[model samples]
Target chain A: MIEVEGLTKFYGAFPAIQELSFNARPGEIVGFLGPNGAGKTTTMRILAGYMPPTSGTARVAGFDVVDQSLEVRRRVGYLPETVPLYPEMSVFEYLTFMGSLRRVPELEDRVDEVLEQVAMLERSESYIGNLSKGLRQRVGLAQALLHKPEVLILDEPTIGLDPAQIIEVRRIIQELGRERTVLLSTHILPEAQQICGRVLIINRGKIVAEDSPGNLQAQLAGAERLVVAAGASCEQLLQLLGGLPGISSVRAGSRDGEVEVATVPGKDLRPLLARTIVEAGVDLMELRTSGLSLEEIFLQLTREENDEQAGG
Target chain B: MRNVWIIASREFRQYFISPIAYALATMLYLILGGIFFINVYFGLETGQITPDGRIVIGAMVTILLFATPAITMRLLADEYRMGTMELLLTAPVRDWELVVGKWLGAFGFMSVVLAVTWVYPLILHRMTSPGIDQGTLVAAYVGLLLMVAAMLAIGVFISALFRSPVAAFFVSLGVMLALWIVGSLASSSGTMGQLAGYLSFVDHYYNNFYLGVLDLGDAVYFLSLTALALFLGAQVVEARRWR
Candidate 1:
């Protein structure tokens, strides 16, 4: 439903996004993960026809953002990072205004439908400025869904919500994913994993990694390690395990009240380490494999990027 | 055109719901009324105005200077300040539609305030039996509307340049003051003076409408100014999309 090719945005002498290119299929929820100032909002603005890219092109629903901006805008709903709203307008009033601007076929009905979808129907008569942050976010979501656009571009859709509100927002996003194309930008890793069908990890204005959560997790399989606990001094443990059979390498450390040894990636070292400990008259307390979580994988990838930059 | 009307109606409705619009209208009515009655009282005592067309036009022009900014300053600046411009710009509306709709919205709002000035003329009519010519009075109202429309376009154009409504108000005040002073000096200076007079919005308005003569040239001038400013506003918005 959306295609961005060689899209670049330059603000004066600085490049906000350089050659950003991505495609989002119909009914797909693609999470755009990046740190602050990482060009996420810039890309969303271009796609929504609010701003023109400095070079290249972006097309939504087969219409060019620059040349066919009206059609593109009609088909894409955008919720900017700041959630642009008229504070004096009541929730229903604001949505009604937005609906009229969008030329919705049945504006009043659409307003009610969207308000219900965002769980703001009860507070529809309340002014937006009087609402809490969570409720305001819901209203923003409702505005984006007003026209029933083919694609929705949300910048940080769930940034500051309380835990319960965050869950509600996530569920609403998930439901939205089932019907239309969703491209949400968030720095929160769990948000991407929970609500996104595919994830694009962006850093410094470039897409560094793009894959499903499972595929990215699978890539970390071989790097998983088993930390074995043994009764020995730190240096002595490192020396004993360095040349042990079936062991790649060993780095000694301490965990709790005992000395721990980190075995490098290889065959299961628990069985071998247990036998070795008995022969060496050392006590074995624990043998557990360390599973790589999504958070750890994200850190590992980003840290590798830092290492590459340092090397260059 | 449908999109333009939609935006225009919503903006027009906003002016009624917010207190700023009412406050501005009340303040303008009080100021215009104060100036009008004070002049009427003094004119009876000193015989300066004498219920003539000149004093009426002068009083209306003075009212325009103060009242124009109240409506026009918030036209674009308030949207930019509240960040709602992004939402409006991203809609399926055309640039010209947004500009014309906003100009009309603010114009309609100022008209409501200007409508309250009718009481002043009514008071003068009751006091002076067979007082003001209905033709001159009707023409004067038309002139005031056209002048306000033209001034509003300029103010709306300036409003687009800033994100603060106060800045827009002050900029509009400065621009209006320059035009008022420049036009007043034109009649004394010859050909160059005549050229300045042509550029002055009030000169043509007072000569044509206030004098009970509706000149097409003067009417076209105000219309042209309004169209030009609105067109420039649309172009400004379009250009910002690229930046």
Candidate 2:
């Protein structure tokens, strides 16, 4: 439903995004994973028809974003990073105005439906200015979804919300993605993993890696570590964990009270690990699997990129 | 065109969202009512029966020259400052729709402001035996409407340059003041005098509509100014889409 080709955008001499090519089919949840200033916003804005890319083409719902911008805008729902809004308007009023601007039929009904979808039906009469940040963000999503567009381009959809709100927003996004082509950007690697079917990891205005989260995780870091914290001494905990089946390696140097236990992929060792610790009379404080952080993945990817450039 | 009306209605509602519209209209009523009462009282005392509108028009020219800038200063500047411009620009609406819609919205509000002062003429007509000439009254309101529309266009165009509405207001006020004084300031300066007279909005109003003459050239001047400013404002809006 969305396609971008050689989408290079330059702000004077600085290239914000360079030679980018990607597409999202209907019902696909594609995550744009990148850090700040990685051209995530630039790409999303171009796709949203906010601004034209300097030297590229983008199409939303088969309409060219540059030439058929209005059509693309009609078919694409865009949620900007800051959630631009008029402070004086009530949530219902704001959504109604946006619905009219989008030329949505049954505007009031559609507005109410979207408000309900974002779980903001009761606050619909409240002024947006008086709403909390999380509520305002929900209203922003409501406005974007007002027209029931075929494609949704959301930039950092869960950036500034509490954990519960983030989970709710993520659930809504995941549900929406089941029916529409959804492209969302995020700096949180775990967020991408949770919501995205596939992710395009962008760095320095380029796509460094693009694959499913599982594939990317396996390629980048095959082994997973379970950070086990206990009241017992590190030596005793490490000894207890060292004899566990399927444990590839065990170490205790990162912190005094924690022992890092490496295990094979595609296995949930948490239950086993927890049971053994309690049976051994070792007080288990915390036990959870730790995924590779974004920084670690970027470091390895860039090093490989540098090696490839040197080889060439 | 539908998009234009949609954008315009939104802008119109925005005026009432703040207290600015009511404030401006109330001030206009007080000032115009004071002038109308004084003029009528003197006429009744001196037994001059014929109703006059010249003094009211004179005062209005200066009042609108200042008042219009305030009404139009937030046309685009506030949207930029509040980030609402991003929403407008990203929607399916055209650039011209956004610009022209802003002008029409302000024009619509100014019309209400002008309408609120209609009681002055109504009172004058009641006080005078023959009453104010209906032709002159029609011409005066039409003139005010055109003049306000033109001024709003100029203000909207200038407002596109700044994100701060206060800055837009001051600059628009400066431009209007310059246009008002240009005719007299250059009266003795030869060719420049002739050019300034052509550019002077006060001269256009005072010589034509103020005299109760519905001159086509005068109407065209205001229309042309409005068209030129709207065209330029649309251009500025379109430029925002560029990287």
Candidate No. with top lDDT:
2
RMSD of candidate 1 to the truth, in angstroms, is 3.0
In angstroms, how far off is B60's CA in candidate 1? Answer: 3.2
- Looking at model 2 chain A, report the run of 10 residues with the lowest lDDT sum: A293-302
Model 1 CA deviation exceeding 4 Å by range: A220-222, A230-247, A254-286, A291-293, A296-312, B39-57, B188-191
Locate the minimum summed-lDDT window of 10 residues in model 1 chain B.
B48-57
- For residues A66-149, could you state the per-residue lDDT of candidate 1 as single tens digits? 999999999988998888888888998889888888878888988999988888899999988899988998999999999888
| TM-score per candidate | 0.91, 0.87
lDDT of 2 by residue, A123-242 (tens): 999999999999989999988888888999998989889999999999999999999999999988789888999899887688999888877877777788899998888898888889
State how far residue A119 of model 2 sits from its true place (Å).
1.4
> What TM-score does the predicted chain A of each candidate obtain versus native chain A?
0.86, 0.79
